[model samples]
Target: MPDTSSYLNSLPAIFSEDPFLGQFLLAFEQVLTGLDAAKDEPKQGLEQTIANLSKLFDPSAIDTLFTDDEKTLKAFLQWLSGWTALSLRADWDTGQQQRFLAEIVPLYQRRGTKENLAQLLKIYTGLLPIIEEAPDRPFQIGVNSTVSSTISADTAQIGGGTPHRFRITVTMKSSSTDELARQRQIIQAIVDLQKPAHTYYELPILIRTDTMQIGSRSTVGVNTLLGSIPTA
Candidate 1:
């Protein structure tokens, strides 16, 4: 049998062509570090701190806890989705505030630009503790590409330029962690695979997700991210 150690050692070299994967690993490390910072603080007035954050970022779900005027749902979403950094006050112990912030990390859906960027930094801070307990392993990944060549280059050309396009497929696999990890990995991989530099000469890669079942008979359901890239 081939030496497993050698194969494992070779993964980094084999993956060198895709340097962006390294960036992802670094980003994930940052996320883990953030979680650690959130856990070191003490707890005092934990409940109130949670309540304040609930009103600010997760108002849609926390709205029932307070009156209408107290709901900052729309504004919070906008703030997170925008491109600015966001700061909030905490009256409770550090752990409690961290937990509450972790729970509301899903508010990223509502963020748009820089505000959303700020929200991400806050989340990274809060998620640091949870990562400390987990072991980091070599992440496994797979890639596939397909192209349609039936379209004639001459017929598909635009304004005497390159042909319009064909189709490209990018299939990937990653071990599941939490739901957030799974979703984030998939999105990042798709973006990396389909960047315009890669796609201008090549067809766009479509990311596909799949599920697997274990035990006696296995089951699986595969799906694609919602929106489609325009072919050019």
Candidate 2:
């Protein structure tokens, strides 16, 4: 059993560097404080602990973590597995609960690559299985036209000279058949918006409807589309 006190020591190092995650860590601390107060049934207390941790990431939060440190994010998931066993003690098969708890506790002790990235991968697959090495993978932001062009009924204009529908195409690599069509749609949106340079745009707005696959089952999940519209 870890002293739990020792875990506090890692805080300064972790917090000093990552303010946003540090604030999240503070919230985690509050959950611990609550756990201490509910010392009656380790089971019930554990359930509360799990609930609090779940709050740390409300589904969508996983996307944010993947966008940052995926490895660390995966390592931290051991805590989630342990919390689950504790939370389901009464309802789950007693043997299964004990087995899961035994398996996951060690992970919290030594986070980072060594503990068991495989197990973590299995656990987080449902949450963010398709984490991209880069944001909007497959379709990365490539060299877009620095200049804009337009064509009117009478003549054509270049570089912001006139208002013409300029078609901008963002290519997404390794896209699945299902996503390839949608990727084109999203890129078209970028052309339609006529946005300026250096901004993040939520593309493929219709992409949420696509059914996501688990693990390496689907390669196309990571592609994304973006459009660059010059102000000039």
Highest-TM-score candidate? 2
Model 2 scores a C-alpha lDDT of 0.36
| Tens-place lDDT digits, model 2, residues 124-212 | 22111121111211211243322222221222223323222122213233447776665454343422332333322222222222334
Candidate 2: list runs displaced more than 4 Å: 1-86, 110-128, 132-232
What is the total number of backbone clashes in candidate 2? 2
Candidate 1 per-residue lDDT, tens place, 139-222, comes to 222321212233221122222323332222223233344744554544344334333332332222223233322321121222
Which ten residues in a row are the worst by lDDT in model 1? Answer: 127-136
How displaced is residue 210 in candidate 1, in Å? 30
